[model samples]
Target chain A: MKKYLKYVVILLLIPLLIIAGACFYPERSYAFVSLIAVLLSCVPFFLSFEKKNNSTRKIVLLAVMTALSAAGRFIFAPVPFFKPVTAMVVIAGMYFGAEFGFLTGALSAFISNFYFGQGAWTPFQMFSWGIIGFIAGLLSSPLIKSKILLIVYGALAGVFYSLMMDVWTVLWMDGYFNIERFFGAVITALPVTVKYIVSNIIFLIILVPLFEKKIERLKTKYGI
Target chain B: MNSFKNLNPYFLISYFIFVLFISIFSFNPIYLTSGMLGALSYCFLILEKKNILKSIIFYLLIFLAVAVLNPLFSHNGKTVLFFINDNRVTLEALIYGAVLALAVVEVIFWFKCFNLIFDSEKIIFLFGKISPKTALVISMTLRFIPNFIKTFRSVNTSQKLLLKNHRLKRYLNSFSAVITQSMENAVITSDSMNARGYLLKHKTFYSRFKFTPTDLFLLIISAVLFILTVIGRTSFTYYPEFIFPDLSLLNCISYFSFLVLSFIPFIFEIKEGIIWKFSVSKI
Candidate 1:
C-alpha cells in the first residue's frame, strides 16, 4: 500500500491536480507539478542504489564520468550547440547501467549549470538527460552490439532532449501547454536540435568503441 | 543568538516550506502583509543593498505588468471597471492580479533566501541522510570536477605541444587521455578506501551539521506556527466577486505566526548584530 501510494500520487493524483489547476488557475500548478513529478521519479532509483554495498568504486567511477561530461560542457562552450555531455551520458548508461547513467546525466547537467547558471530550467535539464541515459541503459545490449542502433539512439536522444526543453519554454511563456507556442518554440529550436543530433552522433561514434574496451577492462579489473 | 545558517537542515527546510506555503496559498491582506514584510526584511538583511534596489525596481515593473495584464484578459469578476478593445475589466480581477503578483514576488524572495541558505555541503549532508551512497557520490563528483579541469588543461597543453597543429585532435586526445586516467585513478581510490574499511559500517553516516538544542526549539516553534497558519488560512474567492475575509481571531493568530515564521532569520540576524555590538562595548 505504501509503495503503491507514490505511484498513485505520481500517476493519478498529479495529473488530476494539473487538470484541476489548468482549468481554474492559468499558470501556477503546471510548472511545479511537472517539475516535481520529474524529480520525484528520480528518487526511487537513487534510493535503490543506496541499498547496495561495494558502492564506493562505482560511486567514484560515477564521479569521474560526471566530471567528464561537465568538463565536456565547458570545452564545448565556444560552440553554439555542440556539447559532448549527452553522448557521454548515453555511453555511461550503456556501460554502467541505468541509475549511474541517470546520475551522470543529471549531475553533469546540474554541476555544469553552476558554470552556466541555475534556474527553473535546471530540473528540466536534469530530467531530460537523466531519462535519456536511463533509456540507453535499458537498451544497453542492443546499443552496444550494433553500431547503427548506437547512432540512431544518439540522434533520437538529441531530438528528445531538445524537444523536452522546448516543452519547458512553452509552459513557461504561456500558462498552459499552448500547442501554438510549443510549435513556435520547436521551430525556433530546430537548428539547435539538429546540432544536438550531430554532436551526439559524432561523440558516440568517437567514444563508443574506445570506451567499450576501457569499460570492459574496468569491469574485469574491479569486478564491478 | 544562533545564526540562520547554523539551524538544522530539517528545521530550515520546514521553515522554507511553511513560509512558501503561506505565500502561495492565500491572498488575504493579512497573509500578504506578513509575507511581504517578512520577505522584505530577509532580503534587506541578506542581499546586497545594490542588488536589493535593482531587484525591487525590476520586480516592481513585473508586478505592475502582471496586475494590469490580469484584468485585460480575465473578465471573471462582478464589478466592471473599464473596457479595452471591447473586453470588460473588473475591479475584482485587478485585485486578484495584484494578489497573484504579490504571491509571485514573495515566493521569488523566499527562493532567493533558499539559494543563500542551502549551500552544497548542507545539501549533501541533508540528502546523505536519506541515501548515503548517492550523497557521497555527488560530493565526490563535485570534488572531481575541478581536478578534471586542471588535469585536462595540463594534458591539453602537453598534447598541443606534442601533436603540433591539430587543435581539435589535441583536445580530443587530451579528453580521452584524462578519461582513461581518471578511471584508473578511481580503481586505486576505491582500493585504498576498501583497505581503510570504508562502507563496512553502513548504518553510520558522517555529516558536519549538528542539530543543537536551539534548532529543536526553533523546530517546535516552526511546526506549531506552520500548523496554525495551515488551519487559520482564510477562505478567499475571486471568481464572480472578490470576497476578502474579515479580521477574526484565527486569522490574526495565523497572521502573527506567519510574521514570526518569516522573520525568524531576520530576528536571528538582528540578535547577532546586537550581541556583537554589546560585546564590543564591554571590551
Candidate 2:
C-alpha cells in the first residue's frame, strides 16, 4: 500500500489537480496548478524513503544534489545561457532514482529562484527540470552505459526545458495557446536555446564520468 | 514596531500567494498598475537603494523587450501600426505586450519582496508544520548552496596554484574534488542527524512568530479585499477589446477595494515608519 501510494499521487492526484484547475480557470490554472503540482510531487519522493537509517541518508544526499544544482547556476552566472544545473540534475537522476532526481530538480529551481527572483515562470521551471530529471532516471541504464546517448539526452533535455517554458510564454502573452505565437517565441529564443543545449552537452560530457565514480563508491559504502 | 515583516510566516506566504496569482491572472490595466505601484513602493521601502535602482532598470529593459516583441508576433488589433514581414503590428498587441510586461515586472517585484521577507528560517517554519523532515532537507539544502560554492571557489584557487598549464583540466579537477568533498559532507551530516534522532516522531519545532490579533485583522482584511478584487476582475475582459463593466456603485466599490488591497502593504510600511519616528522622538 505504501509503495503504491507514490504512483497514485504522482500519476493520479497531480493530473486530477491540473485537470480541475484547467476546467475552472483555463488561463490562470497552469501557473496556479503547476505550483500545486510541484509541491504535491515532492510528497511521494519524501515519503518513498521511510526507512530510519536510509531515509536520513537519502534526504541529505538529495539536499546536497539540490544545492549542487542550484550552486551550479551561480558558477556559470558570468556566461549567458550556460549553466551546469541541467547536467547536475541529469547526473542526480542517473544515480538516484527518479523520485530523488525529480525532487532535486524541482527543489533546485524553487531554491535558486530566491537568488534569481521568482515569477510565474518559477513553477514552469520546476516542472520542466523535474520532468527532465524524471525522464533521465527512466532512461538511466542506457544513459549511464553510453556516453553518446547521455550527451544526446542532455542536449535534448535543454531543448525540452525551453519548449516547456515557451508554452508558459505563449499562454501568458495571449491568454491561450497560439501555434504561430509559440513558433515566433521559439525563433526569438533560438540563440539562448542553442546555448542551453551546448552547455548541457558540455557539462554532462565532463561531469558525468567524475560524478559517476563518486556516486558508485558512495552507494556501495553507505548501502544507499 | 508592527510591520509587514513581523507577520506570521503562514500569513506572509498566503498573502504573497494570493497577490502573485492575481498579478498573473488579472490583465486589467488599472489592477496591474495598482499592483505594480504597490510592489514598487514596497520594494523601495524594503530593498537597498542600489538594488532597487538596478531592479527598476532591469524591469524597464524587460518591459521594453516584451512591448517590442509582442506586436511582431501577435498582429491582432484593429489598428495596425505598420507591417514588418507582412504581419500587421497592431496597437492592441503592443498594449497587450506592455500589460504583460507590467504583469511580469509586478510579479518579479512582489517575489523580490517575498524573498526579502521569507528567508530560509521563515520557509522552514512554514513547511515544518506539514513535514519536519522535508523542512529539514530544505533548510539543509539552502545552507549547503552557499557552502558548496565557497568550497568550490577555494578548491579552484588552490588547484590553480598547483596547476597553471592546463586551465580546463585544472577546473575539471577542482570541480570533481568539490563534488566528492560535498558528497562526503552530505553523508557525514546525514549520519550525524540520524544519530541526533532527527527521524524520531513527535519532534518539537521552536518558532519565534506568534499569530496575534493584528495578524488576524490583516489576514481578514486581505482576504476580504482579495475576494472583492476577484469579483471586480471577473466582470472585466481584456482580449479582443479591453472592456470594463458598467460604472455601477458595486463596481466602483470593488475597484476601490482592489486599489486599497494593492496599497495595503505600502500603507502598513509607512504607518510603521511614522510610528517608529514618533517613538524615537519621544525617547
Candidate 3:
C-alpha cells in the first residue's frame, strides 16, 4: 500500500502544480508544464528500478531490446514512416511489466536519437512511445490472448502516437496551446498519420508472433 | 574534449537550461533576440562551414512558417492586419508568432551544440548519479546497436543462400531468426554476469568529466546572468494587449546580461582560438 501510495501522490501532484504554474506564468507555462510533467512521470519507475539489486541482467536485456528496435529503423529505411520499433516496444511491454516497458520505450527513443539527431520532437516521441508500452503492459493479458485485439491495439497506439506528436508540433510553432492551430497541424499531417498507422499495424501483425515465441522462451528458461 | 566543452556536465546542462527556460517562457523580443544571436553564433563557430548556409535557410523557413501560422490560432491584441475565416489576424499576433518562432529555432541551434558537447560518456556520467542502471542501459544499447545490425545482416545473407525467391518471406524469416539469436545471447550474458560476481556496490561509473576552476567561474557567471534575465523577462506581459518593454536602466542591463549569457560559449571559443594561435606562433 505504501509503495503504491508514492506514485499515486506524484501522479496527482503533477497536474495541480502545472495548473498553478500556468496561472502564475501564462507565456512560459505551456512548455514548462508539458516538459516537467512528462519528465517527472518517469521518476516513479526510475526510482523503483534504482533500488533493486541484481539489476545488471535486467539492464543488459533491456539494452538488447532497445538496440533491436533501433536496428529495426535501419532495416526498414527503404520504407518511409514504416519502422518495426513500435512493434518491438509493444512486445517488450506485453511480456515485461509496465516499468520495464516504459524504460524500454523511453530509452529506445533517446538512444536512437543519438544517431538520428535529437530535437524538440525527441521528448515528445519518448513520452508517446513510453505511454504506449506502459499501456501495452497493463493490457497484456487481453492483447496476448487475442490476435484481433492485438491488431486493434496496435492501430490505436499508432493513432495515439501520431496525435500526441502533432500536439508537440502545434505547441512548438505557437507560444501557447492553441486549439485551432493544433487542428490545422493535424489536418496538414494526415497523410503521414496514415503512413504511421499502416506501418505500425503491419509491423505488429508481422513481428508479434516471432517476438512472442522468442520472449516466451526466454522468460521460461531464464526466469526473466 | 575541447577546453570549454570539457566543463562538468552539470554546469553545461545548467547553462543550457537557463537559456532554454528564458527562451521558451519569455515572449519578450529582447530575450528571444539575445538567445537567438548567442545560439546562432555558437552554432556557426562549431558547425561545418558547408552546413551553415543550410541551417540558416532551415531557420528562416521555420520562422516564416510559424509567423504566418500564429495569427490564425491566436486572436489577441489590436491592429488587425487581415481576416481569415472570421478570425482577426492581428499585427501583435504576427509579432508573437515571430517571437515564438525565434524561441523554437534558438532551442534547435543550442541542442545541436549540446549534442556536440555531451557525448554518450557525459550522458552516462550525468545519469549515473541519479539512476545508475539507466545510464548503464543507455551506454550498453549504444554499444549493442552495431552488433545487432551485424547479426541481422548475417541472418539475412543466410536466408538468401537457403531460399530461391520470395524476398518478403526471406526478410521476415531473417528478422525472426535474429530475434531468436539475440534472446539466446541475452540468456548467456545473464549467466556470465552471475559468474563474474558483479559487486553489490562499487564505482560502476567511470566518467572523465572533471571539474576545474574554469567550470566554477563559468557557473557563477551563468547563475548571476540567469537571474538578471529572468527578472527582465518576467516584468513584461505579452497577452490581452501589446505592451512595449520599458527602456529602463534595469531592462537594458538585464538585456546585456542575457546577451553575455547566451554568447558565453561563442566568446569562450574565440578566446581559446586566439590563445592557441599565440602559443603555436611561439612554438
Candidate 1 chain A weakest ten by summed lDDT: A169-178
Error of 2 at A83 (Å): 1.8
Instruction: Please compute DockQ, using alpha carbons, for every candidate against the native two-chain complex.
Output: 0.50, 0.59, 0.66
Q: Which lDDT tens digits does candidate 2 get at residues A48-131? A: 543334567788888889998888788666667878899989988888877777878888998898888766677778878987
Docking class of 2: medium
TM-score of predicted chain B, candidate 2: 0.90
Off by over 4 Å in 1: A1-36, A78-81, A109-123, A145-148, A166-199, A216-224, B25-37, B55-102, B159-171, B235-243
TM-score of chain B of each: 0.83, 0.90, 0.92
Native-referenced Cα lDDT, model 1: 0.79
How much is A20 displaced in model 2, in angstroms? 12
Candidates 1 and 2: which is better by TM-score?
Answer: 2
**Which of the two, 1 or 3, has more DockQ?**
3
| lDDT by residue for model 3 (A1-224), tens | 99568646554576466455545655555765777677777677777787777456677778888988998888767667888888888988888776677888888898899888887678778878887888788789998899999988888888888888877776566535667878888898889888877888888888888777777787797786
**lDDT tens readout by residue for model 2, B139-203:** 88889888988988898888888778576566567667778999988888888987998878787
TM-score of each: 0.81, 0.89, 0.92
Clashing pairs in 2: none
Q: Show the lowest summed lDDT stretch of 10 residues, model 3 chain B.
A: B232-241
TM-score of chain A of each: 0.86, 0.82, 0.87
